[model samples]
Target chain A: MFLAVTGFAILRLHSLFAVVMLSGVYSLIAAAMFVALDAVDVAFTEAAVGAGISTVLMVGALSLTKQREKIPVHTPLLPMVVVLVTGAALIYGTFDMPNFGDPDAPANRYLVDRYIQESPKEIGIPNIVTSVLASYRGFDTLGEVTVIFTAGVAVLMLIGGARRRRRPDSRAGPEATRE
Target chain B: MTFVLAHLNYWVVVVLMMIGLYIVVSRGNLIKKIVGLNIFQTSVFLLYISLAKVAGGTAPIADERFTVYANPLPHVLILTAIVVGVATTSLGLALVVRIREAYGTIEEDEIDLQDDEE
Candidate 1:
């Protein structure tokens, strides 16, 4: 439901506001699902990154401009059909997903369990998620930080830099010329 | 009430999350986008807090009394996440202010049109 609604919003909404909100909706749903799966840490990170900070920045961009201008809209039928087919395929794939909280599930039996059981002695962190995110995947986290930093720098250098001055008042310029 | 409250955190998170997402996607105003972002970030806080609960455990302070304790790990993780969230928001807002100054408009289409003219 979250993905479907948000997908529609991203597709159909002309204004940036609706699109950002729909994206937030998508993140929120994912957070809930994370909790249901007993992955609280992932849920927390997603909620913060997906819902909170991103939305605020996007909306801030919405200010200082004319609210959406109306335009002749296209139906976008082909994209919708493609999305529907993709969604159906994804749902079909989920049939092979382990039941909710299955102890014997491959996911449970392998990676997460190994981390939970072995990390205590290895990395010495009580929280498996933290250990996984910080230690084993430390390089990935660093890369993510670098990406964000680069994005910030790129936006600043590109869109956030100096403004072009507007033309001087025509009347004032003409009066000065006449004088 | 407590039981419902515990379970309903998910729903609350969902609603707030959507509201934020809608603002970010549908709105052209950059400030509105940031506000939506904040709302979305808050939803994650709710999810973490819900999972951190130990049902019958007290606050995580290790004292002589209140033996049962809610998990401390989630709280610690959330604190870091909160810092990161703040950092991102400030950066994003800074970007928006700059965008407005440069483009002279916050509307995405307007900016694009202005760029095309340039």
Candidate 2:
């Protein structure tokens, strides 16, 4: 589909700017796909985070680095073989997975019933997803927020300062400032 | 034919995953590798959403008109994951910036050569 095509474009393009834009497009298409697959909440998050924030961050990163990818000197044969084997293995494993969208699949069974049935009575939320994410899995959300917080702190520490280097050969910038 | 149709979504996802993997493993550019990693992670999100489908289901929002709601668990999980993926991506990019500042080049082979000489 669109994702496959966009992914291919990203792979083939040497220009980091184009690749970054395509990645944003890929994320938007993925958000559309999520909407089609009954995941509106996920679609919203993907649209904002994947397409919006990630794209900006990448462009910022690209500004700090080279624009064009060098033509790889080594043949991609080994990586090609590895990807083929891994892909084949994954496709083979999919045979055991319940057919796409089967309601009775393990993924749709079990705690799902509890979340759907009990959530209304227990959480008093009209939206089952909200109930589950906010109440049932509140701790998980807290942890996810914590993860984002940690990442923010890490990014700030990594690149927040505009430290000056006396010489290009001076190794003190990254090592000395890094803690 | 039915089998292929049934699993068509998965096959596409697998292809996307492979492409991402190839980019990561084959390319020397650090930024390119990070973009590859983004592709890989997005495909995984697709796989999860695909699995959450229930044929004749509406979005996980509960409504009286709709009896079937797609799995809510995966939606919740993937929502968190998307955010986390961005977090990790920003982190990776930060490291790339640092690497560029430190080494004066972002090519893996060039960095390797520099390391070998030292």
Candidate 3:
């Protein structure tokens, strides 16, 4: 219920600061939901990443730009129609999916049994999530880590690194010309 | 009635996904768009986690007393995804900051207008 309310608030609110704050609240709520669903690790990550780091980064970005959204000149009707159609289609599609927590579901039926059954003998880890992530899917985790590294480098190159060099000269030129 | 009841969680998730999609499509503010994107990504994470659940199962830890365990694969996959999400978000915000520096405004329409004039 709170998640829905947060999403709605984010949708209706125009103040960028308020939106940022609400989105953080939304993430925290999402983390709590993850906990209820028995995904403690996911909840931890969501709280740390979604609520913590992302909020801080967004605030940093906000500091560089205007806070209030300009009143939109275009009508929102077209977007609204598109969203409703897409949403309806998605809901219809979910009718074919397995029930919420069916053990016999295809997602649960496949290699999961092997992971659950043999992982203790093979990897000898108490936590299956940690064992699989670190051993069974180590390469994928490495790739993900590399992707994060690349993103950090890319962000540094894009804004943090280049902006300093350009700030002293080009900053005045653009705003002056715009005015 | 059982079907609807059983799938209520999915329905709520779908609604959240649509709200995210709506924000992405309608909002022109670059930062707001990124927030929308985050919401969309989070909904996807929810869908996967929900799919991984087992009725009356504990977290995927090996315990002699607890035989039923939630699927660990999805949890592992989503861990990676959450990391990727944060990385993408930071990069996106970085781009937005640079956009503001280059264009003098973060509004998409205004940025386009500025580009046309230039």
Candidate 4:
């Protein structure tokens, strides 16, 4: 309910600054909910990345862009209809899903049992989530790290080239005059 | 009544997802669109975490005192995903900045208008 309110608030707000702040608050509330759902690690990450890092990045972006969302001119009827239809389909699809916390649901069975039962001895790590993330699925984490590194390099290159080009002020003088 | 109670989280997730989608589709501002994308992404994360829950389970830390733990696999996956989400978000913002530099406007309509003249 809290998250839903935050989402709606974000939708209604025109100020990008308020939107960014609400998003951070939304993430904080989501992190709290994650704790309720038995995903402490995810909650931690979401608080840091979704709330902390993303908010900072968005503020930085807003510094370079407009602060207010322009009131859209169109009626947006088509998009509203499309969203309603898609939402209805999603709700219908949820009918077949296991109840919120059924222990015997297909996803909670099989290898999950194995991992939980054996991880203590096999990996000798008390935290099954950590063991699985750092050991069982180490390669995936490595790839994800590589991806973050690539993103960093890509941002630098994209922004770096622009800065370098700006330094050649004499050339920009001619272009500015021609325009 | 039981059905609604059983799937409460899912219903909320769907609503949130739709809200995000609506913002993304209806809004013309580029920054607003990115905020919508963030909302959309967060809702998906909520869905995954909700699915990983076990009614009586504790957190996925191993202990003899605890008999059941929520599925750790999804937690692991979501952790990685959250990191990736931030990375992509930063990248997208960088692109937006570059676009603003080139076009001198971040309004989608304005950009389209400028393109049409060219």
Winner by TM-score between candidate 3 and candidate 1: 3
Candidate 4 runs further than 4 Å off: A167-179
Clashing pairs in 4: none
> Which parts of model 2 have CA positions greater than 4 angstroms off?
A161-179
lDDT of 3 by residue, B17-93 (tens): 98999999998999999999999999999999999999999988888898888999999999999999999999998
lDDT of each: 0.56, 0.88, 0.89, 0.90
Model with the higher TM-score, candidate 2 or 4: 4
Which tens-of-lDDT digit does each residue in B1-118 have in candidate 2? 9888889999998999999999999999999999999999988999999999999988876678988889999888988888889889999999998888878889999999999999
Give the per-residue lDDT digits (tens) of candidate 4, residues A50-127.
899999999988877768878789999999999999999999999999998999888888689988999989999888
Which candidate has the highest DockQ of all?
3
Candidate 3: residue B59 Cα off by (Å): 0.8
Candidate 4 deviation (Cα RMSD): 3.7
Q: Which docking class does model 3 fall in? A: high
lDDT of 4: 0.90
lDDT of 3 at B53: 90
On lDDT, who's better, 1 or 2?
Answer: 2
| Candidates 1 and 2 compared by DockQ, better number | 2
Per-residue CA lDDT of model 1 for B19-101, tens digit only, reads 55655555555655565676667666655655555545544433345544444445545655655665676677666656655
Candidate 1 docks with a DockQ of 0.11
